[model samples]
Target: MASPIHQRLREDVLASVFAPDEPLTEAKLTERYGASRTPVREALQRLEQDGLVERRGKAVVVRTHSAEEIIDIYESRIILEQAAAAKAAVKATALDRQLLTGLLTQMQQLDPSDGRSLAETNRAFHAQLWRATHSPSLIGLLERLDQQVRRYTLTTLTYPGRWPVVLADYAELLAAIGDGDSARAGEVAARHMSDALDIRLKMYAEDPRTL
Candidate 1:
């Protein structure tokens, strides 16, 4: 489990409270988080390991990914998500399936234009899917990839005409998992990541600032 200071800093960074490339000094962080110097320093170290922060010229700052790096992250996510979905189809227990169903229902009820709510629910749904796989190694890898992607702070679901497609994808993915259809689950998960990548690249091309 992450310490409170580390979790607080991680959440702020992922939420873009600290902008990309913003410098994070130990002294300032200690004051901001009401933490002692030791915990503040340790939290920064953990964030660095998580790839959310990095050292440059002896200063720690939020990590910023190049376009190429973003693409690479998504590509890795595609493979891992595909395998996770397939494994989850075989391994998901009754409780895991119940949790997934509940999250999907929450997502479906969200207004299409409410991007923030939709994104939050979508994240929970995916996290549940990862858990359903019952593989620690795979879950750890996916969590790291997720941490890097969340630092981007933009959802592909916010793209024009994307929300409905995402809903449909989730519905199909749920159905496949519920029916124990590993092949279909894997295919849907892979396609979902591919679609997200396509939208993300398009966004970057149109306006680099949007990302």
Candidate 2:
């Protein structure tokens, strides 16, 4: 069984792997995660099985998105997010709306230039949205997709002037959900996901190797 130290190392690997520019190696991971080589090796092996990391010769590297993988992920996200939004709009309790509103408020106060903070908040917001559906299976599926989306979104965050637009879309999505308009909520969610995918696809086209 993997120890707690190994699990923590795995999470560190996932978070640091957000940027494709970085190469993940046991030495760097050991230094950064403050763990021994044994745990780092174990963590990397687990990450590889999860499809989050891969072996490159003797080095372990973060998995980079290919064009096809990007499309498939976006396609999956669109279907899942739209369905979740529609369900959430109809089924979300008053407490759920309030919670989502609170997250949006927090997001609005964040500095758009702070990619790390924004990424964390952005993830929280989406996870909360997924939870609104009250479907464990759906939530679980979205959680898996979330990891893939995070990598793509990280790339998009590097582009200048994209955060504001992302916030605006989140605002629109919140409004639809708050109004209990299932169809509109679904439409907005689909459009939002589609836009992100479009940006990621463009980024990949510009540099296929980086993704």
On lDDT, the leading prediction is: 1
Q: How many backbone clashes does every candidate have?
A: 0, 0
lDDT of 1 by residue, 84-182 (tens): 999999999999999999888888788888878878888898999999999999999999999997966456788899988988898899899999999
What TM-score does candidate 2 get on C-alpha atoms? 0.79
For model 2, residues 114-188, the per-residue Cα lDDT tens digits are 778888888888889988999899898888877754555766754666777877887888888888899999998
Candidate lDDT scores, in order, read 0.90, 0.80
Residue 80 in candidate 1, Cα distance off native in Å: 0.3
Model 2: lDDT to the true structure: 0.80
Per TM-score, the best of the predicted structures is: 1
TM of each candidate vs. truth: 0.96, 0.79
Q: Report the error of model 1 at residue 188, Å.
A: 0.6
Model 1 lDDT at residue 69: 93
